[model samples]
Target chain A: MRVLVAEDDRSSRMVTRRLLERLGHEVAVAEDGEEAWLQITSGEVFDVIISDWLMPRLDGHRLCQRIRRRENDHAVSYTYLILLTAMTDREHMLAGFEAGTDDFLSKPVDEAELVARLRVGERIMKLEQSLEAQVGELRTANEKLHADLQAAAMVQDSILPRNLPRDKRVSFGWEYLPCEQLAGDILNVIPINPDLYGVYLLDVSGHGVAAALKSVMISRVLSNDPLGSLLLGETPEESVTSPSRVLALLNERYPIDENSSDVSFFTIVYGLLDARKGTFRYANAGHPPVMVLRNGATELGKVGGPAIGMIDNWKFDEEEIQLDDSTRVYIYSDGIIENPNEEGEQFGYDRLAELIAGLGMCSTSRGATVVAGEARAWNPTEEIDDDVSVLVFGGDE
Target chain B: MSKSYPAIDQERLSAVSGGDREFEKELMEAFLEDAQLRVSQITEALQRQDTEALRSAAHTLKGAARNVGAAAIANVVMKIEEAASENELPGSDLLGEMTGEIARLVDQVRSSGT
Candidate 1:
């Protein structure tokens, strides 16, 4: 153990130093409490300190208080303090403890008692130091985990379609929020032909790493690239896919087994729009109800079926709605309506119908932002409880 | 310097010395030099008529004096410290007496070392 003896008197300091050195410990000397404070705070580590109760510039009580504050900084280890005092009254001892003193010894210190007390303090300090090191290791590991997750999230964002195929007649807008670092929701825009465009919104069954990996796989197959994915035709000249065949092809590729505990599925709504004729054709899986805005609000729920990747050889029904210059359609995942407010009341279809009616005059991107803002405001925590996705497809004004 | 002051607690000093004659002599020499410095500080504070300074100087001297087993000097300085802290301290009379005793002890330790 390394010991520091702080005293205003030269003789007491020398005597204390000689006694401690005789006990097989390294000794550091301080002329007064102020010097002791400087040595301790200047990054010189010591295991035990024997400070006089009364000092000129600083005192034992103040030194103990400052040492206790250093304990809050995890980088520093605990130091055992033993204050030497000539006054041994009960009231004074109580005051010493209140100022963070660990132990006390009377003046004219006996050599045996001083050695014994230092050994006890050293043992305690060793235990505390090991515990502090363990905590530091855990803190460093936690920081690494957070950084890795953030990098994964950035990679996922890079794969998303940056800008939709430039079209003069229609505009596309969307909002995506993940409850964790990786989201289960994925949306994309693909150019099917010069006049037709395909838009898809898919939500995996669960959240976190597995669902995020599955989403990346599904996005690759649905993306506009034809050379790598199985969904496209062999010739580069004919790679675009039809809207109804999109879900059917994904159902065949996405694996499913009832016996497997990890078997999962996803919901989807794939739409094809013809800007020249104002025609919209779509295939809906087990997702949220799609709204068609024209003279008034109307939900197209007749073309609904089970989520994709769940049934084999199940023919998915396709429906088409003739769009007009005033027509704008909305397709989203179950995340929006399923969100519960503080009163446990859900933001249901009726409320969403009312919201879409009010947003009839806004642009597609502005409308998506407004809808997401209203849904989050309905909850007390202002948190989207699940992976939220909103896609609004509308005609240009 | 005089020998009228009370004798130091030899038993306490011996326990600290651990029967080492050379170590005892070194400690006594250091104590005497330190005591002289403290005596001057108390005398200066009394001349300045600063009660707070008197309280602080006496209090520090009390603890250091006691550490060398000088019970008589420690006792008198302790009284002055307590009284001055409460602002009821006596004047130069008490300060002179304590400084005189401390000076005499310094000389006694010096002669004994020879």
Candidate 2:
């Protein structure tokens, strides 16, 4: 260890130096507190400083104060300060401690007691060094995790529907917001043919990476090849499969495994839209009701079955809605309506319907944006706690 | 003679010296020079009736005397320091007693051949 001896008297300085050197510690000597401060600031770090309390220039207490200030201001390595004094009263000891003295020794420092105190200082220094290193490592790990999550979020965003099919009979718009870095909510519009399109909005049981991974898998299964998916019939003629049959296929494929520890489930609304006829046939499996924005807002798809993966071979009933050019249809996750305000009241379906109706003759895109904005505004934090998603179709105005 | 002052404590001197003859000789020589200077400063301060200067000079000598195991000199200097710290100059008689204690310590150091 490196030791610095700051004493105004030459004989005491020599005695301390000899004792420390004998103990196998490197020794540096300063005639007074001022010189000691200079050595400390010269960039050579010392482990311990043995300073005499009374000196000519810059007394030991003031030196300790300055050293403590530098440690706080610049975050320098800690230096254990031991003050040498002839005054053994409790009052002087308290004053020395308040001045940042780590230990106190009498005028004639005993070698045994000095050695014990230095050992304690050495232990404290070692502990501090180790703690600093651990904190540095944790900081690095946290940064890496944040960067990785951002990259994953970007990948998820890229898979959303873009350059939506242009049909004069209908238009589409959507909003997606994830409360965390990863979310289980997914929505997409797949063009099965020139006349028919497949649309879906799904919410898996949980959040974060596990739920997101399942959503991604389901998305790939549904949208990878639209015409070849369960959305179409098996007969080589490529007939559009009924909404009820497609949901039945999904129910058969995904069932809650009794053996698996992490049992999972999902709520989804899948539909087939005939753009020429403006007929939407959809099946809801334990999802929120689909809203039709006609005169006011009417709820549909409530006549369906329980959530997927809950029961095997559960028959999901289908429902159809005839949409005019001026009518808009919305498919959304429960996160939108279930979000709570400051008073713990949910932003229910009634409020969502009213906000959409208030849009009057706006475009489907503007309607989607306004509905999402209203849901976010209803909450005091202006940030939804769950994954909020909305898909709007139709509304030629 | 049942004197009030004993020049040195051998046990303490041995402990501080760490069985090093050269270091012991060095400490004795350093104390000899520093003690004479501190005693003369105390004398001058007493003549001028300066208690602060007397306290400071006595404190310096007290530390050196204690380090070298000259307990008698340290004890005498400590009394002078305590009096001076209270803004009271020691009488010429107390200063004489301290001077005599330092002289006895110097004789002991010389006679012991260290």
Candidate 3:
């Protein structure tokens, strides 16, 4: 073991150094506390410090205190500080304890006793060093794990739609906020033809990764299915001619209890729009009611049928609306109207209707902006518990 | 009359030294230096609200104290580390007491003659 010897007395310092050397230990001599402090602070490594309690230019007590005050970056290395003191008074011992001395040897030190003390210091240091190394490794591993989780979050966000199609004949807008790194709400607008478009919005039953994965699965299914063919036709009237048929197909294929018997059903609103005819053929599967605004008048479209994937043969209600030249339609998930404030009062459909009615006086773009802004303001401090999504269509050319 | 100072426990010391006196010495010096450096690092970490660094410094100090047979100091260091890791400062009194203990230890070691 390498030892740091701090002392003012030349003879005592030499004797200590020779004794340590004879014990097969390397020794570094510090003439006083100040010198020892300097050596330690210089980033030199030592196994133990055998320091005298009294000396010129900083004493053993001060050195021990400084050593104790030193910060440790890695694992603990045992630096045993043995205070060489003549003071045997109980009060003096108490003072030594206060000064951070690990052990004490009275004046006219015995070689055997000194050697034994050094040996003890050596043993303790090794134990601490190993423990510290293990701890450092564990800490590093934890940091890496945290970093990996964050990277996964970024990948999840990348899968979400970035931009929506913008046209003068029809306007499209949406808002999405994930409760966590991933969410269950999925919305997409797919163009089937020049004059025909399919707008789909789905909300899974729960939140987090499981629900998010399901929503993604549903999105993939819709993207690859033959549903796009239904939107393509010469006349606007032919587009989405059967809203109930689409629901029936989905319900048959993706039964909720097939994978799990739990409540795995989802609320979906699928609409086929014809730009030329200014009309929409839509089906609502136990989802939130859609809102229609025509020339500053707002009306809630009725909820059509049971949620898809709930039962094997659930019938759906098809709805059609002829949009006026200045008409605007709003469709959304239940998260919006069902959001509750600190007072436990939900921002119910009634309140939503009022907001739409008030904002309907302006252009579709402005109205959508106002509604989103107001909803956020309602609960500025608290987090939105569920995913909030909004889609607005029909703007003047 | 021969002065019979307490006999140093060679076996315990060797065990603590991991059978490497040079390595033990190096480790001890490194720990002291690190502990000193950590004081400033702790201050910076606290100022910047770096909980990770604060926790790390406290943990290191605690371990080093135990190795050097400073059990009381180790206990205090452990408390500080726990508080810092949990992102709570605990109380000013505890911090003050720890600082006082460390300062006194440094003073004693400084005064001791080789």
Candidate 4:
């Protein structure tokens, strides 16, 4: 190890230098406290500083203090400060520790003792250097992991519907909020035929990465021919006309597993709206009830059976409602009602029903505006926990 | 004439040693060499207008001096380093006094040949 020897006397400096050299240590000589300080601060690395207590222009105690202060001064290694002191008083020793002296060498210094102290200083310096290097590597790894997670989130978001179709007959609006990097809610508005439309809202059992992956799987399955037909309960002849059977078939096909004990099931409300027939036929598998507003009156559509995937061979009942010129239907997942406020109260179903009723009393065109307003009012200051989906359909004038 | 020894001021030596020859020699050596190096660096740092370097150099020198029993030199270096670090130089007379003390110590050591 390279050591710095700070002594004011020529003979003493020489003798100390000889001692350190004999121990196979590199020694740098400083005539006084001030010079030793400069040598150490000059971007030079010194493992230990063997300094005198008394010197011209900066004595040993002050020198040790200065060296301690410089320990964190640069990007280089650590420096151990050893104070050579003649004063062995308890109070003085305390003062030396306060000044940041790592160790003390009593005057006149013992050769063996000095060597042993240097060895300790050298070992500590090596340990500190290794620790610092490890910390830097860990920081780099953390940054890379964060970047990868961000990239995955972007890909997940890209799989969602970009924009719902805009037509005079139907008004579509939706909101998606993820509690983490990914969300479990998935909504899609796909045109099954020229005059037929398929609209569904699905909420996976949980939030975050696992739920998001399941949502993507459901999306893929729904997009396929056989699974799509099965999920929609499409028959060879009546498949295009009825959406209720599609949901029933989905429940029958993929029953919820009871023995596995995993909280991984989804609730969905899917409907097939016929523009020419002025009718909406839907299948509800234990999802939030849909709302039908007509002539300033609101009614909640009943769910036909238990939620999809909850039980095998669950019969899904179908509900058909003829929408008059002044009628509108609203469908949503449970997230909006489940939103909690700072008061710990959920934006319950009652509030949602009231908001729908109030909007029906007002006008059909203001349906979207009223629903959003009510949700905000329910939890004005809190963040929404899940996704919100609202679809409004108006009949021909 | 064992190595033509300088007339040892027994009283002064004993005063510094506390009845230890090795302690006296170590104290004298640490004081002279540490003081001179620190003072020289301080002078150079001041000439270069490097406030940080000047302060640090002076501070280390001060601590080292105080450690081995040179309180007077430590006090001077502490003041210099602090002033330089704060961008304030002490008066020329004070600096001269410190340098003069350093010279006297060096001369005393050289003549004594301890």
Best by DockQ: 2
Best by TM-score: 2
lDDT of 2 by residue, A1-397 (tens): 9999999898888888888888899999999999999999998799899999989888999999999999999988888899999888999999999999999877787889888989998898798788878878998998997777777666667777776777887889888877854777889988888878899999988656667767877788677384437776767785677778878888888887879865778899999888878898899998999988776655544566788888788888888888886578888889888989999999998888777777755787877778877787778684565888889988465
Which of the two candidates, 2 or 3, achieves a greater TM-score against the reference? Answer: 2
lDDT of 4 by residue, A68-136 (tens): 666556455567788877668999889888988878887655567777888788788788778878888
RMSD to true structure for each model, in Å: 5.4, 3.5, 16.3, 9.9
* Model 3 alpha-carbon miss at residue A124, Å: 10
Could you report the DockQ of all the candidates, in the order they appear?
Answer: 0.47, 0.68, 0.02, 0.06
Stretch of 10 with least lDDT, candidate 2 chain A: A295-304
- Clash tally for model 4: 62
Relative to the true structure, how large is the alpha-carbon lDDT of every model? 0.77, 0.83, 0.69, 0.69
Q: Which candidate has the highest lDDT of all?
A: 2
Task: Report the error of model 1 at residue A81, Å.
Answer: 4.2
TM-score of 3: 0.54
Regions of candidate 2 where Cα sits further than 4 Å from its true position: A65-76, A85-101, A204-207, A210-214, A224-266, A303-314, A382-384, B1-5
User: What is the Cα-based lDDT of residue A334 in candidate 4?
Assistant: 76
Q: Encode model 3's per-residue lDDT on B6-100: one tens digit a residue.
A: 11233433444546656444434444555567667766777787878888777656644554434455566677778887897646665666666
- Per-residue alpha-carbon lDDT of candidate 3 for residues A105-179, written as tens digits (9 for 90 to 100): 765445678778877787788787887788889999978856665554455456556876666677677666655
Question: What ordering of candidates by DockQ runs from best to worst?
Answer: 2, 1, 4, 3
| TM-score ranking from best candidate downward | 2, 1, 4, 3
